[model samples]
Target: MKRALVIGASQSLGSHLATRLASNGWQVVGTGRRPASEVPGSEGFAYERLDLSDPEEAHRFLEGAGSDAYDLVVHNAVTYGAIPGKPPALDELEAMFRVNALVPYRLLHGVLAAQPTDRFCSCVVVNSDSIYHATKQSAPYAATKAALRVLTTSLADTFRSAQVSVATLLLGPLPDPRKLADFQRVAERHDVPVEDVKRAFLRKANPFYVIDDLIGFDACYRSVEYLAGLGPAGNGMVCRLDGGSAGSLI
Candidate 1:
């Protein structure tokens, strides 16, 4: 009766992971803006419709999502808020950091505080490194994720004794021929359908394409999963996925 909690389960990747977890025998608890309208098929699971952007709601949901404990916490929720529609007074960049970095940080801490056991809880988070160093436009979103990676590693180092684990899913590029031909190489390397990989991109249509690279996602998921399985001690680990052209973590 393992229970898993997933944040931002409305997206394709999040929804897919929810279904995948349910099929693998874990009872799933998820959150979204419109659980009733966008709720993923139960597949023998449950969901709550709430905006994780609301810190209080996010904290409350994480505090008691499952049977007083979560075997795994897959944090797939994020926000770029980098769109050009807002005014400077609105502090869009700050807001991006709040959701992309701050909220997730507080949620993790809250989760730890509420746990009955002193042990570290297993966690998986979604992020983008290519956005940080790879490109310049996504500075706000990229910096937050980059900082989060460091924090996750630090947690891994600080909490290994308790057996809690946290890992980041760092993504690369998608298989959009218009962008680059190397997408197919990456898709084949990870064994994920081309479409499944497309969700990583940020575009206005289809899977969208704001994300700079999707090719390295499979490798990212695998390496993070491996580190998480190793418990909190796996934190300081600098695992990376090079996609098709690279050999190993260098």
Candidate 2:
């Protein structure tokens, strides 16, 4: 029974992944701002409140947890919006950069350094295709995920000796309340039914299952398991979640 740490376990997507892993016999430790007594499939799993926005706080917390040699580390915690009220572009950029890039960039080394050489472990950095799009509502957010993608790849190079793996899960439309509500509010204000917005975001344009589906997490776990079994060093792989599940979107 290997241990796994998830930084954004409160998110629907993270919660789904954590539960799946726990059901499969992994010791799931989840961190989030609002710690639930328990979530689906995580009966006795550990839950902690973590505000990783403060990099130093995150560093200290990780250093103190003492599960340094865990089998898997998922750096999926992230802040998606611009500063409250959608601050000036520069200010928003500053905040997003820290949450999306700098913290994980440095923490990867600390977490990896804590791990042992014998186990085949990997880190998955969840990303958004917003990084590849133009004039995204949250360009800074996109930039940060892109940065993580680059960092994950570079970190893989360093893990050659320890045989650890690093990967980027370029995620698409998330089906969580946060994003769906965002769509709902905007659609309502503009005199459009929320269903229309949902259709575009998930059914046609994106055509993928949202974060709550957990299918992507299943794929993620399998990919890591496979990568870890190999002797380290493999090309980065890209996976899409919803392709034909478009009918399930609305």
How many steric clashes between backbone atoms does each model show?
14, 1
Q: What TM-score does candidate 2 get on C-alpha atoms?
A: 0.76
**How high a TM-score does candidate 1 get?**
0.70
TM-scores for all predictions: 0.70, 0.76
Off by over 4 Å in 2: 37-43, 83-89, 182-196, 202-236, 240-250
77-124, model 2: which lDDT tens digit per residue?
888764544544776677667767877777776777778777767676
- Scored by lDDT, the top model is 2
Which 10 consecutive positions of candidate 2 have the poorest summed lDDT? 206-215
Per-residue C-alpha lDDT of model 1 across residues 1-250, encoded as one tens digit per residue: 8777777676555666666677778888876676455555644467776575677777676656633577677777776564544432357767767777777777776664555575456877766544435344555566777777766666555555554666666654433233444445667899977655554433422122344445543454455457667675555454443242213243
Which sections of candidate 1 miss by over 4 Å?
42-44, 82-90, 118-120, 131-134, 174-225, 242-250
Any residue pairs clashing in model 2, and if so which? Answer: 208-242
Best by TM-score: 2
What is the Cα-based lDDT of residue 58 in candidate 2? 75
